[model samples]
Target: MNTIGSWQNHAISLGLPPNTPVKKQIDEFIRRWDNFR
Candidate 1:
């Protein structure tokens, strides 16, 4: 998704790898937040 890509880009700008576990955690967090909303 474009939003996911944009988030990954932001993470990369902060020096994290796109495929890192931190990225996966953030993705999961967003998914849960969206579901809760």
Candidate 2:
């Protein structure tokens, strides 16, 4: 998948809205990256 597609997946998996702002998405991902790590 493309980068945007992957970003959407990440947001969805985190229970975030697909339309979430990019900065919020990044913060959420960073906060929960241990799930992947």
Candidate 3:
């Protein structure tokens, strides 16, 4: 998804790998947010 790509871009900008824990946590939060809607 475009939104996910943008989030990953944030990781790239931070000089971290694509699969960082911070990204994982953000993805989980997004999943919960979509469910909450």
Best prediction by lDDT: 2
User: TM-score per candidate, in order?
Assistant: 0.46, 0.53, 0.46
Error of 1 at 22 (Å): 0.1
lDDT (Cα atoms) of all candidates against the true structure: 0.64, 0.74, 0.63
- Tens digit of per-residue lDDT, candidate 1, span 1-37: 2455666665665456765566575776687679999
lDDT of 3 by residue, 1-37 (tens): 2465665665565455765677575776677679999
Candidate 2 lDDT over 1-37, as tens digits, reads: 2455766676776689877877898888787786778
RMSD in angstroms between candidate 2 and the native structure over all alpha carbons: 3.3
TM for candidate 3 is: 0.46
Q: Give lDDT: candidate 2, residue 28.
A: 80
List candidate 1 segments past 4 Å from native. Answer: 1-20
What does the lDDT come to for candidate 1?
0.64
What's the C-alpha lDDT at position 2 in model 3?
Answer: 46
Deviation (Å) of 25 in candidate 3: 0.1
